[model samples]
Target: MMVRRSGRYTTWRGFKDFALGKPPDEEKEKPKPEDDLSNHDEIFLKSIVESPDFGRKSEPIESEEDLVVKPVSLDNVNIIRSLSEYRGNNIRTIEQAELAILLSRIHFKALIDAHDAIGALWLQRGSGIEEPPKQDKDTAEGAETSPEENGDMPVETVKVVGLRKVPGQPLGLTVTTDEHGQLIVARILAGSAAAKQALLSIGDVLLEVDGVQVDTEEQLKEAVSKPNDRVTLKVGPNLKEKSSQLTNKLSCYMRALFDYNPKEDTLLPCKEIGLEFKKGDILQVSDRKDPNWWQASHVENPDVVGLIPSPELEERRKAYVPPEADFVHKISICGARISKKKKKFVYESRSSVQLEGAELALYEEVARTPPFLRRVLALVGTRGVGRRTLKNRMLHEHPRRFGAVVPHTSRPPRPLEENGTSYWFVSREEMERDAHAGRFLEYGEHNGHLYGTHLDSIRAVIKEGKMCILDCAPASLKLLHNSSEFLPYVVLLAAPGIEQLRNLTFASNRNLTEEDMKQTLEESARIQRQNEKYIDLVITNHNNDTSYSRIMDALHALSTDHQWVPVSWIY
Candidate 1:
């Protein structure tokens, strides 16, 4: 019959003392609540305590034969010894011994699982359900077979991996199953942790994740989806051949079509690869193989390399148009009104406006034309006289022979403008400093911002062997007439007589009032009468198409016909 205790039994204490090789101490018995054990626990304890040679010293098992009849107590002793040896220490007291026993249980459990898995794998290998082809030593030494030659044969390899996780981010590897039912790596994202590690490669088969064997793509994905900060994986060898293809780089220059905001795009790999460009920026395209995007750098800033939308994929911003009537027209009307007010002030003061010595010298200098190596075509006109429209037409007609001088402005760039392309965007201080240093040929203030034509900017176009064209203020002509190197062939674009002006339609959104038309006529008449000596040719703009043809004819005559030039250019 089995002995039963009525009061509480210290089975755990007894076991702990036994494992630690400590003698049990005798004391007075104390009554406590009885804790019952389940059938499994009772059986386990009985197997451990009632076994023969439970506490006997024994030799270490050296052969397989010795392990066949090993007792349960001996096996427990071996497990404890193994754990202690692994930890580089020995179990000393009851508490330490108990903790060591628990840890040893867990360690053995994991070891048993790993051993079972390895055993199953070996069994499958021996069973010959599927086998790899064997190569003869002599034949392998003579000639190695290429991967392509091994048509349908599966190559087996193994690898161990550890992947660290970032909070709420993916592993950044795309995987798919090959024809052999092996999960293979397809793509690695540009900026992911996996990409940084760079241990895995395309065409490498995935074997297991987190110790779970993965045979299919679904299994691999599910295993990787577990919630863990770090992960481990087993993978096969990479089978892809080393490529010998060369990269061909082509150089191109283009203008940015639209604005780019990198934060708005999710697919960009990193900040370095995100191409942030403003409209009208000239880009140097170095790679154009991608259908939707191209690798490029800013022309003004070559160090900035990134991906930008292809010309086919991006919509370009249209040319800028003034909110009101053309700026040239506004300038002319304002000048006329100011001159009329000044004359009225002079009459009230009972003083006649007379030219002083300095003023007479300035007028005489401007009246004399200077010699020039090349001619700058300057278009001058009153309000709504079609100066800009005619300049654009001339450019379209003669693309190779002419180029426009992009002006400098001390104003912030608009959304569709870029520095050195639409306009040379600069600060007020820089523009003022340059102006004081005589770097500008002509400078003026408009809308509370400074706008000017720099000498170097004009020469930049001239250096390209093309005639420089400008639509400028009348004051600029006076300055140009004084310089021998920059003498302009001034063309005054005049409004037609009142009858023809009434018949013509203006191409602006602002309503052309009678007062506005009247002011334009007066301004045109004043320009023709006062600047007749400086004007090379005066063309009345009645019809756009007809006027364009007449201007082209005039330009042709100027280029071919001989005219008077200053003696300085001849010398």
Candidate 2:
């Protein structure tokens, strides 16, 4: 039978004979291009079954021998030294293993050092930057023209102002944004590296560093940390700011009443430039033209100028704080809370000047005044805090030094009582009218007799050259303490802890229960939260004598010390 093979039909009898391993026909053996039957190029046909296992059925091998004839180990692989047996005499395993890595690192560091040294040598021989094109005489003269000579319009300067960074020292300069929203060098910390830069000023406006525009501290820091640690800054003068600084000849100082970290203030125009202040931090307010943000710096370091929120801005942020509930409804006399029925507090007068200074300004303008005693010594605290006792002691022990404002009364004069001595005796109709006119500070009826402290009576004590000592309610502080008149130095007689109050032996609060002590703490906390800004000093009235002595010391210091009173008290 003929079958197709090698793209041509050929006889299949020889192929069937080759596969059967039955000896080949031997008649002829066709050779392909790859097969050579003989060196003479002639066919020498042989039996196809001559090879070993040629006819046996194909099957898997059950057993095998190793194929790798030349297997090697660490000992044999290294001819110089047997690596498997090598170990240090004293070095630990970790150190021995890392020796090569350490040497490699050393080599790398040496290479880097060599590179830097070579580069420095080459840098010394390198060409310098090309000189800038010279400006014409007219252009140079125009540059020298003053801003004022140019019709109040500031002449733009095309130059840079900066300080060099000393090696191994910080820049010691803080950044802030100006009113124009430009980044500026705000504060130069005391004893900092930059403070040595005499030419650099606090308000100098920054435009760019290392030719890269930087608007934030982060950006500036990134720009400054170039290949070379030294950086160049492009600065423009804040002409308007300079004018404002010149206009404000007097150093306007203020006492910060709140802790303000600019970083935490989300509303601050630029947090990086905002001045941080703690409670009672004396600050010199440099600029107040912006009603929201005032440029100020710590009095301790007035060289650093930074923005702080204005009083109006901070007050608006706090929103409307209604009158204190306790101060409004209840009445505390001599650091003791009395019942509403007993006190008979006038509801209409709750909104009076009692709350005038209650919500104290965040920053109070303060100035050091000549040695002078406070106009009024107003004491405040909850009931059973020994306020009345302290006031009475001050008056009793030092009669000439401390005096009380003899209140007015609508009741008829008693047999022995003299006018302006026991009480200011006034007709009932006239007293009612004066009380209605807000002349009476704490007016209310007591057993059908109208009795209350009058503004005029407090003034009378002041006119007598005596500190008018009054244990008035915390609410009355607003009406009594002010910038114009009645600059009362308020003191708070605070309640002790429950444990301290419970173990008190000197205080005569035998009637107070556990709940009463807790109530006192809560009330004291409320008053402190509401009127702490108004208070000048606080004395915990755990021991009456100790507190009394402390109060005496405070009163003595007030007169002798140069008081930092509200600047409004002066100009």
Candidate 3:
């Protein structure tokens, strides 16, 4: 069913007459990386680095400012090329987009040392050069400025010393960047002497080494890598709060890269093993690395770590299996919302739903009707237009009624937001990092912010048996227009008229002058008309009870005809 022949679904009888012999359509073409420009942001790139799904082709950020990096491998090129061809042919479908992300590579690297060999290791998130450290005032004042210096820090290089194995522990080292940077131990071999002694823990976040300052991991490594080092290490206890600082230190062995761990595993000496979790506890496994799940549950016994032999393992897993005919009876729903939080407008929603299982059995007849026979309901409006509020109202007013359109982005978060929640925020640095790494659906930029919508969200909504209610900027229309997998139900929400818009704007405390209100109205109208071709529905917020009634009526009509799933669970 996922495959297409002659650019049409062979199973759908009328599809052949409707789409057969059509002009070369890019959306119908094969999908690839470079061609998915709809989600052209940095965070999407980072996801590729962090995604467990990354295949052979992946990339990483080299520095803090490396946002918007793109992948450069041959695989990446091929994927991009496929997308380009698809776009050129005007083939629009979600299947093509899904193919692009699945084909991307996972990028990572491992740094190893002597005699500390273990399992093979792959790079994970936050695996890159730390920010350079600062130097002491006296040391900085005395040092001569470089020719290129314009009152800025001079270029400094980091060097690795021979790794030293702690008594009864794996090898590691004490490193230092400069006077301003704090000194700390780096990379303690898992189960190494230093680790067993418990005198030194990785990610101690060293504050100072023998009264010297150090900040970055590299700097900490440098300081402890000295001869006859009975150095004093002042460290802060790891805490979530900034004000919670603890310090301690003991004698330590310092070193550089260790013996190659062909099966790259084990932490570097002095490196914080897991800042977020306590000792002996398994840290959240990062998808970037191919960790042996069996090894993680290591009970100090090898036999138990091996694969479990069972007949069930070889057999197909069963679910609350539905019949093939059930998919035809599925319904789709979408939701959108906007709110003002912390002085900034925050938009959020449940996004999409796909109703299936026993639920579809009840509506099998209606679900089999022609896909286009019903009128689709699409809502398009500017930001802060209560689009999301209305979506919530429908669900409140009618339970189990709507689906959502998932939006994707590659923008990194500012110490807020969570993965798969607010937005899949990653570093712009990581975005560019993965761009070159080659992982994304469709990416683009709007209002200086980058946005992307991946296929996973689309598949998720469909899997839930609901129509997707998507919320995005106007620019995204072009990308959606070219993709067939996403059958758009667009509705343009515009202000009633200029005079009404001015009155509403002022009433809302926006304090807009008549001129400002008029200008805004003109712009909104232009955006609406520009996207007229995609508009399947329209609602006017003309500052009267009529607007709410009209909008509600349109939604009810659409639902009655099974044109769309409501924007909420109830409506």
Steric overlap count per candidate: 0, 2, 139
The lDDT of each candidate is 0.59, 0.63, 0.39
Q: Estimate each model's TM-score.
A: 0.36, 0.58, 0.30
lDDT for model 2: 0.63
lDDT of 3: 0.39
Q: Which lDDT value does model 1 have at 507?
A: 65
Candidate 2 lDDT over residue span 457-481, tens digit each: 8888889988899877766766655
User: Model 3 compared with the native: what TM-score?
Assistant: 0.30
True lDDT of residue 5, candidate 3: 16
What lDDT tens digits, residue by residue, belong to model 3 across residues 324-386?
322111211100111121221232111211111111110000111222422223455764344
lDDT at residue 66 of model 2 (Cα atoms): 18
The worst-scoring run of ten residues by lDDT in candidate 1 lies at 343-352
Please write out the lDDT profile of model 1 over residues 7-103, one tens digit for every residue. 3335645765544444568754333322544345645654565466753533433544332321112123323433543332344677877766676
Q: Which regions of candidate 1 deviate over 4 angstroms?
A: 1-374, 502-505, 568-571
- Using TM-score as the measure, the top candidate is 2
